[model samples]
Target: MQTTTLTSTWPQTLCDPSGRRQAKPRNKGCTMVIDKGIGQHAFADMLSTSGEYIDIVKFGFGTSTLYPLPVIQSKIALAIKHGITVIPGGTLLEAAVRLDLIPGFFRQVLELGFTGIEVSDGTINLSRTLRNDLIRDAKSMGLTVYTEYGKKLFGSRIDVTDFARTAEQDWACGAELVTVEARESGKGVGLFDEHGECREGDLSHILRVVPNLDRLMWEAPLKEQQVSLIKSLGPDVHLGNIPVNDIITLETMRRGLRSDTFELQQVPYSEYMI
Candidate 1:
């Protein structure tokens, strides 16, 4: 078996002046890719090229159910070998729950060798009890559970208090991380407005209310959204729903390689220098 090794040395000229960038095996600043459907060779190529920068890979809605069993299994195996967690979108899980196939769903998911599970109610209505149940159940099956908040409607907005409470409850229920859903376009969902712009006020409110901002993964799919978030929450904020091609670009942004946040590349000797 082959292994992937991440380089620790960063360009000296690009070091953060504040010295706050994080490396891999991190609890925060996670980057999750959304895979609609890519071939096995292409998927393997992606993992070989940028797997270290990716923390999770979501199969994106019901697309997982459409793939050939071998392809799905191969992808999951590649990701697991790279220490990346791979799972189907929460919407697929929701479909199973609605059809009363939750047990079969879990069995099939485990059989497929998926190491992660996303529990979300973006399109359906789930009671608090049911939501917690899903989290507990997934955890019981030895899956890394990632629960999502916020609806997918165009004008939907997040209630800071409710989100905070739900986030805390989900964490207590054994969820590894809670994701804020912004969908693929990243517009008109969660804290984003119609133009794919983030509502700063809403974001600040959530941060103020939530106990640990690190536990929340914001689904930012656009370059501008990624820049704005890195600026607001620093490079350590967990971001998900990232497009496949943008993985390295997002990593560059996080490491101050991009002009959007070039100012972060000035590490003070007192902080980062040994």
Candidate 2:
């Protein structure tokens, strides 16, 4: 999808240090919303209001199964209309892997209008061979494959070196991006501590080691985590697991319209000219 052009109350090129783009840079940064079964009507409303800022909309966890077929279809259709990529959450894919339903999962995903797939081993163990195979299968079927690099286990901290390696492998396997899991809670998992604080040192280490930060999605559901990541990585870092309602807030932060990230933007030079 092109970098969105938003019609706003304020001028487009006003205070933004880096001007808004004709196409939003996904590698530079994007926002992925984790939806836990929002009704199609509500989903449509959200898209209408803030779809420009949303790059990906995930039917979170296994809740996609809980919705009626038409509802799921409607939501996917809504997202596609706004140029947003839609996919079922990694956990659902993990469940399919657990039940030996991989074939059916892919067919159904395409049938239901999902344009992408997430291959993850959060709750299940997938061998290296199986992981690569899944990526190849998804790609062969013309699906965008997004692999995740961390477990959903409670005490699972990132093994920085392992993550760096897996990210490279996933990209080579045709995955679009590697998501670092923080689950819904965003506590005690990946780079987050139990108190929902980011492990700054770990994040710094990964930033230095990982060849490309643009190919990663950080699942940060908390406001503090959002602020910290923006501070450390700049406003355009890809953030995932965002609540359905917080879409605007995140967008504001990215645009430097929010105080949390206002400092990230510099004053426009035109102001001084006057």
Which candidate should be chosen as best, given TM-score against the real structure?
Answer: 2
- Model 2 ranges off by over 4 Å: 1-9, 15-26, 269-274
Put down candidate 2 lDDT per residue, 1-274, tens digits, no spaces.
7898777675655545445422543556688998897787888899999888888999888887888899899889989989888999888988998999988988889999999988999999989899999999899989898889888889899999999999999999999989999999999999999999999899989999998787898999999999899888878788998999999888778777788877766675686668
Task: Evaluate candidate 1 by giving its C-alpha RMSD to the native, one decimal.
Answer: 4.4
Give one digit per residue, the lDDT tens place, for model 1 in 1-274.
Answer: 9887977886555454335555567786899999999999988999988988999999999999999898899999999999899999999999998999999999999999999899999999988999889899888889999999989888899988999999999999999999998999999999899999989999889878899787889999999999999999988889999999999998888878778978667655685577
Total backbone collisions for each predicted model: 5, 2
Q: Which residue pairs in candidate 1 have backbone atoms (N, alpha carbon, C) closer than 3 angstroms, thus clashing?
A: 15-265, 16-266, 16-267, 17-266, 17-267
Mind sharing the TM-score for model 1?
0.91
Q: List runs of model 1 lying over 4 Å from the truth.
A: 1-21, 267-274
lDDT value for candidate 2?
Answer: 0.87
Looking at model 2, residue 64 earns an lDDT score of: 78
Reference-based TM-score of each model: 0.91, 0.92
Residue 192 lDDT (model 2): 96
